[model samples]
Target: MTERQQHKRRRGAGVAAGVLCVCLAGSGCAQSGAAAEDAREGEAVQAVRSAADALVGARSSKARTSMEMATGGTRVTIRGEGVYDFRRQIGQLKVQLPQDPAGTPDQRPIMELLAPGALFMKNRGAGVPADKWVRVETRSLSDGNLVTGGATDPFAAAEVLRGARTATYVGEDEIAGTPVRHYRGTADLGIAAQDASDGNKESLAAAAKGFATDKVPFDVYLDEAGRIRKVRHRFSFVNGQMNNAVAVASTTLLYDFGAPVDVRLPDGDDIYAGKIAEE
Candidate 1:
């Protein structure tokens, strides 16, 4: 072979090698970018899972709650305001029900005392004496008192995030004038029950079984301290009366961290034992 022809062949080989090197380098860069994205997603999920613990660190906070239920083309909204003690797993709320079909004047608000394993209510309007409180076991309620009480317990609502299966950091936002990071996710109720504290274990487990699906979709906002400023959960359960599924959207907003919350349970004598009328 001619020397010039040999030199040209060598040159061609070098060019081919260079092209292969560039392709490999590009692949490595793509992989690195994907790995970084995965790491960011993992951090967001970890932040969300730890939000409940952050609230516990804050001790207590003032809260506002709204629960909207839709069934058979009818929708009703219930609102409540109160204070919660995360450490004690207790709180108090005054819940106002929507107006009746006749558009009657607003009814007296139902005063509720929320505890770890029990719930107490006065003026519940089921034939119980107004002066007496009615006590119910949290685990006994089909929805685990999440829907029955007309408001989700603040701490319990936070605990639900413990089961976040998938999460994405949406962006920064403000809630009630406080800067917060918004996250969207879906949580598994069964998984939440497994990781929940002893006081909430049975109740959450019951909710997991009673709901139409164990999956709960939620949007949560967290402050700089990783505390939950707001959370909204969408729950669905079968309505026994209508023999259809009812959709419920429950929202809880927390602010005024370090607020005083004094929730005293009623004495046994102060609770009514009579058969209560059904709604």
Candidate 2:
């Protein structure tokens, strides 16, 4: 070969080597990315497990809960702050009630205390005695009722965590100005607490509409201590009983672990003495 031809051949060989090296580097990067993703997934699972364990071991906590529901042109929202006792499955939450648009300006917001077998409601409105607590016996309420059942049970947290099937670290977030790690996963609906009241389960099922029943998605945030800071769930329902299945979404935040919760059953005088009191 001529000298010029030989030089061109060597330049072509050098270009091929450079291309090969580039391809190899790209492959290494791809592998590293996959490994990092796997590590993040594993970390998510461990974080969730740790939070679940902490919830199971905790005695009590201060909790805030909010749920928004939309069905058939109607929208409803319930928000509350309370003290929850995990061991007893009972709590005293001050639930906030919607204001009456046409009601008097002097009307005060409603608050309720939910305990096992009984509920103490305040500000139930006119015709009901003022400054008195209306205690409703839970046994008379149907299984589909909210507070009448175990809606406030702390064990529900365990149920949520345990039901997670495949979890992945989504990213980091902050709740109430505190930094937290967020993990998202698909939940096993069959493992949801069957012993809980239908109202509670219904809320969960309602959020799963249009999604696979076996794999309802849920998100949980944990603090540095591996304690759950917040949990969010969305699902939809298709029930024959309603005009159409409703879409439901719920969020729960937990803090002040092991905090003292002063929960008391209603006093005899505080209970409405009437034969039939509206709850």
Candidate 3:
């Protein structure tokens, strides 16, 4: 694969791996293990629910947030360092990669070692194409979740995501050197963007072109402390049959009590350059 493709794969893997760390609180193997996993999972789910609320109340220029969770047979973790650039009118979300697959959070991602600059600086611009196509590039970390920086997007959505099912806490378990409680359940995240006309046509198109044409669903998990443990995401992409399924699995941890996260808006040149490349 090309270096760019490799980077995208690596970053995607990192996010999934990082999320796995905090999201999935492992279950006990035998009957005893199952009981242990159940005990703490409920608490973990509650913690995440509360943290999501706290994020909604925060307004910081910069901060760090992490979450952990578990889904069907999978553990995910995600870590992020957010930078708010007022001049730019956006937030710079820097996510680290997972160091250990067994459930270690990405305290540090070797992203720099891969390459820098606007990951898809050469794409149809700073955002996806407006035509609803699948354009994969080595972009920077996400401000929070699937969508970019905004209230209705993944990061902001988490803060006000109601309709969450009660979680059952499982007991503590050790993963990648960390001890955690486990929680299990599916989170029905009905996210609707308030403003779908943010001007990032390419980006939106690219993202939208996939799911509808294919079938995808959202799966979630939590840790013993009620923190998000894992998220198993399966979606349809433009290259449905030929390409592997487009899935995002993540975990979160180390939430910043009430810190605000700033997301930087892409500049004119970033988008223009990407458009030019596409042209």
Q: How close is candidate 2 to the true structure, as a TM-score?
A: 0.63
Better by TM-score, candidate 2 or 1: 1
Model 1 residue runs over 4 Å out of place are 1-8
Question: Which of 1 and 2 is the better model by lDDT?
Answer: 1
Off by over 4 Å in 3: 1-51, 58-90, 95-166, 172-181, 191-238, 241-244, 254-279
Best by TM-score: 1
How many residue pairs clash in model 2? 9
Model 1, position 32: C-alpha lDDT score: 99
Computed on alpha carbons, the lDDT of every model, listed in order, comes to 0.92, 0.63, 0.37
Per-candidate alpha-carbon RMSD to the true structure: 1.5, 6.5, 22.9
lDDT of each residue in 117-149, candidate 2, tens digit only: 455777765456777777765434432122222
Candidate 3 per-residue lDDT over residues 53-170, each given as its tens digit: 3333443234343434343445555565544322222344455544555665634331110011122112122244543222224122222123221111233323322323445544
Which candidate ranks first by lDDT, i.e. highest? Answer: 1
Better of 2 and 3 by TM-score: 2
Screening candidate 2 with a backbone cut-off below 3 angstroms (N, C-alpha, C), the clashing residue pairs are: 206-235, 206-236, 207-234, 207-235, 207-236, 208-235, 208-236, 209-235, 209-236
**Alpha-carbon TM-score of each model against the true structure:** 0.95, 0.63, 0.38
